[model samples]
Target: MDVSGTRATDENTRPPAVIKATARQLLVKVGAGGLSPEAVAGDSGLAVAEVEAVFPHRDDLLTALVIDAYNESAAAMERADEAARAAGASAGGRLLAVTRALRKWSFDNSGEFTLIYGSPVPGYHAPQETVPPASRTPAVLAGIVRSALENGELTPPRRAVPGPPLLRPEAVELFGGLPPAPFSDVIERGIVLWSSLIGLLVFQVFSRTHDSVRDESAYFDFAVAVAAEGIGLVVPLDDGAHTT
Candidate 1:
């Protein structure tokens, strides 16, 4: 039946996946500088030639990892938003759900999170192909804003931020233009919100606020709620606690 040859073919097809998995492990242990075809081969029990055959170049492997991490993180947020919508949560609540999903993903895959969001990989300039996946996470935020505006759930902020079009032309085109008047600034605020969310996770994942923040989960909710206000979304703060 030539079972051994068939098995060999199957194994050959899986080297990229195996090599990437091994690379991620090494990434956590020794940082991006430690990544190389030989390192992945040694960890995956594959020949260096096999790893190189799959990745072709070190930058190729790094790009794949970046894209994978971005897509996975975006999927996590998308899933959370879908579930929140199914549950009839408010736009603001969905925002919270997605942000919380990101935090959860960052916690679960800290190494991958750092790979994408932490310091830039030394000398690795990700190609343009990385942009689409990189945009997915922020696109999730933009989608939420668009949905909210459509449903009349999004409010216009009282004060303008002094810039009529804070979103760049490319960003405007990418997001399909800003939400109409009064809400025109929502996307800009959303950009701020997105950056704030990432900054919050970065602080926690990198232990920047360990000494100061008493309760990270609670703090995140508070910070997100505050940020959401700038976007005209009203996220509920801790429901149980009464502040005097």
Candidate 2:
């Protein structure tokens, strides 16, 4: 009995788990760029044909890993937000909690975080299947912002000199007027707030800030505060006084 043939048969028959396991190991061992059917097969002990049978190409593997990372990140955000609510935090605090949660996940899972948030995987364009999972984390923040706006917790930013428009006319329809046409500026700031979280992580998690940020944790909290305020999560005057 040839063990290699038997193992190959198992890989061929159960390609889904084997391929997923292979992709996960490849992400940890070689990062996204190193993800290929050959590498997956080599590490997974599957035939190259077996790996390709499931993934088809490197992009397929990348999409699987990307979606996994996105889902995990979203779950982390949701869990952190839940903790914030448990502590009787305001909507703004919940937003900050999710941001901090995701940032912490980025530090812990740097490779996967980079796979999702870092850079594009060169020629690989993620298909539409990735959209919903990819949108979950942003939806978390968007929900908070929409709540703040509806509940009158948000302070609409006053742009000076009436600068050029940021979002297209179509974006209004897409947002379903949550910010409303009158407060489109508010939605714009909401987007920047979302990006700021990612930017902060890229800076800290990727070592771009290195010596520039001596206390990254404090800086992150401070930045989260700024971003929270940017989206109109106000710290009550009494609460502020009590903390310091």
Candidate 3:
């Protein structure tokens, strides 16, 4: 889609697509603050006026990039989940699958990943419009939780943990309202699962664990399996043992 929210056809989308493609390249070299209509135009071989025609303001271009990154990352997870479902994998298996897919995407597209998940670009506040695409990845996680609950793959904690509701009204509504009883705690666990997934990816992507961790891929599976247990999922680790 173009900045105007209109779906872009082949001919029209080509320019914005080219512009965005070029902008992504620039994001690596110059960082977000360095992005501008003139920079994209120069790198893309288009006139500055043409770049401005699509993205008159720099933030418009940044928003488009942010939206694209979220969508592409979410698409990877969604694809992984679909494949796991087709293979009759359990929800725990699907959780591992999606996180693995996202991990691969983050490594493959570190620049884009960092663009969205890395440090905030100075002076840029994401508009409310970014919310939907931003929600897609976590929504995928929530779907896995819902399926697990329905299929009897996940059990809520037996005892009510003493605390207020983990999710606010809006977040609860967004996930199709709270599940009954302690089952709602499962949703909170799903949230932690999502956060830990991203946190692990960030640590790996930024090379924060390179010194201490050997065989990152194996380590990721182990970590995600551990996280799954927090939500009552029983994913198998690399050694073929389920997380306790």
Q: Which structure among the candidates has the greatest lDDT?
A: 3
TM agreement with the true structure for every prediction: 0.89, 0.81, 0.89
Task: For each candidate in the order shown, give its overall lDDT on alpha carbons.
Answer: 0.80, 0.72, 0.83
Taking every candidate in turn, the Cα RMSD to the unseen true structure, in Å, is 5.7, 6.5, 3.7
Per-residue C-alpha lDDT of model 2 across residues 113-163, encoded as one tens digit per residue: 888887787888888888888878877887777777777877765552167
Would you list the rank order by TM-score, best first? 3, 1, 2
Which regions of candidate 2 deviate over 4 angstroms?
A: 1-14, 160-165, 168-182, 235-244
Alpha-carbon runs more than 4 Å astray in model 1: 1-13, 238-244
Give me candidate 2's TM-score against the actual structure: 0.81
Per-residue C-alpha lDDT of model 1 across residues 13-47, encoded as one tens digit per residue: 57766777777788789887789988888787999
Cα-lDDT of candidate 3: 0.83
Q: Cα lDDT of model 1 overall?
A: 0.80
